[model samples]
Target: MTALTLQNAIARTEAGRARAAELAVAMNIAIVDAGGHLLHFSRMDDAELGTVDIAIKKARTAALFRRPSAAIGEDSQPGGPLYNIESTNGGLVSFGGGLPITDEGGRTIGAVGVSGGTVPQDVTVAEACLT
Candidate 1:
């Protein structure tokens, strides 16, 4: 139960889609395994093509770090510890919109990423999927 099943990924994606619909935002969503490998993906009809790679990268960032992508972003600032982190990992996305998906015991099993909206909005949608 720790790792997300295909059904789990789908449900998560659906939840994110529902949340994005509520906000009237079209989004590109991605789900990745604990190893940061992609599992499933969805791009809304109106989602921008530009966000596709961003969504996947966000998912990978969260999965690889076992933390929210924004957290990495925060520490990657000018004088932060992860300043050059974005340059590594094949160009990770440090901004918001990425989150680790944990099990009931609080261990990250996978991650979800969302894009095609403002940072806050992307976070909101990403959180929705994890719920």
Candidate 2:
């Protein structure tokens, strides 16, 4: 399987950042390899200071789980199948801004996450980077 490269990570970060700008929201963005290792990150000026770790955690959660973090978030709600799962894996972020990065072969090569915007806006920005 092909791995995510630094160049691609940087490109993706820029793309996400641009989308966040278009949304008129400052953001903290993170890209992580399939192994949940951070490959790139950016904090837009005026982004919420608290969102930095959240962005990284979201990317790691998506990369390690190979699914959008929002799905996990849904499942983790009360009475859901994955209830309390957020406590696992050194704290997985179950939120909308995290998405797996899939390759042409349909393999998840990495993930991207954005924070500091509303959940929908964050998701939109991250999705823009994947396209």
Candidate 3:
């Protein structure tokens, strides 16, 4: 019902980052609008450099596909219906830590992604942002 503005993205990213800190894991966080355009991003000190791109990809994938990237990852495994789907869309990141951000009207407004930690840790941080 409403656009995902930069202010909203920044607040979400900060919440996610705080959760990551509490978990004692550095993280790279990304937030993107429905169109897969970046709204905000943050890479915590000591976070893995490589996860910067992965975080962005996760956010974009979640926003574009309108689902958790973890679900996509599960479906994209061998013998699954979405097998090899990751190879499409210039490389979709079908992994954990990507989650669609829904508005009060239950419409997807954007997405949040977390990386630089283990899958579970990343998922936890990402989910924390939704609260």
Candidate 4:
């Protein structure tokens, strides 16, 4: 299977950042390659420092787990020891606004994360690129 490249993640990150800024959401956006390494990231002019770190963690979580961060959030509830495993392994964000990017063959190749906006708005921006 073809693997995700840093270049692709960078492009997607740029697009996601542009989209987030256009929407007037002061957010931090991050994109990670399939290997769960940071590829590109951006913070809006007025975005908070914490948002940047959270966004990166969110992207890494999605890429490393090969699922949306929201899914992790769901699994993190009571009776889900799996959530603990995810966190222990690192790169797990149990929150919304993180999405995995899959190839045509349905293989996840990367992930994008957006923060510093409402849940709906963040999810909307993240989904915009996943599509």
- Which one wins on lDDT? 1
Error of 1 at 4 (Å): 0.8
Worst lDDT 10-window in candidate 2:
13-22
lDDT over C-alpha atoms for residue 104 of model 1? 92
Clashing residue pairs in all predictions, respectively, total: 0, 0, 0, 0
Scored against the true structure, residue 45 in model 1 reaches a CA lDDT of: 93
Q: Which stretches of candidate 4 lie over 4 Å from their true place?
A: 81-86
* Of 3 and 4, the candidate ranking higher by TM-score: 3
* Model 2 per-residue lDDT at 94: 97
lDDT of each: 0.95, 0.92, 0.91, 0.78
Across 80-121, the per-residue lDDT of candidate 2 in tens digits comes to 999999999998899899999999999999999889999999
* Candidate 1 root-mean-square deviation in Å: 1.0
Candidate 1 lDDT over residue span 1-131, tens digit each: 57789999999999999999999999999999999999999999978989999999999999999999999999999999878789998989999999999999988899999999999999999999988
The C-alpha stretches of model 2 lying farther than 4 A from their native spots are: none
Best by TM-score: 2
lDDT of 4 by residue, 1-131 (tens): 57767667666766776777778888787888788787777788888777887788888888888888888888687787564654565546778888888999989888888888987778877876665
lDDT order, best first, reads 1, 2, 3, 4
RMSD in angstroms between candidate 3 and the native structure over all alpha carbons: 0.8
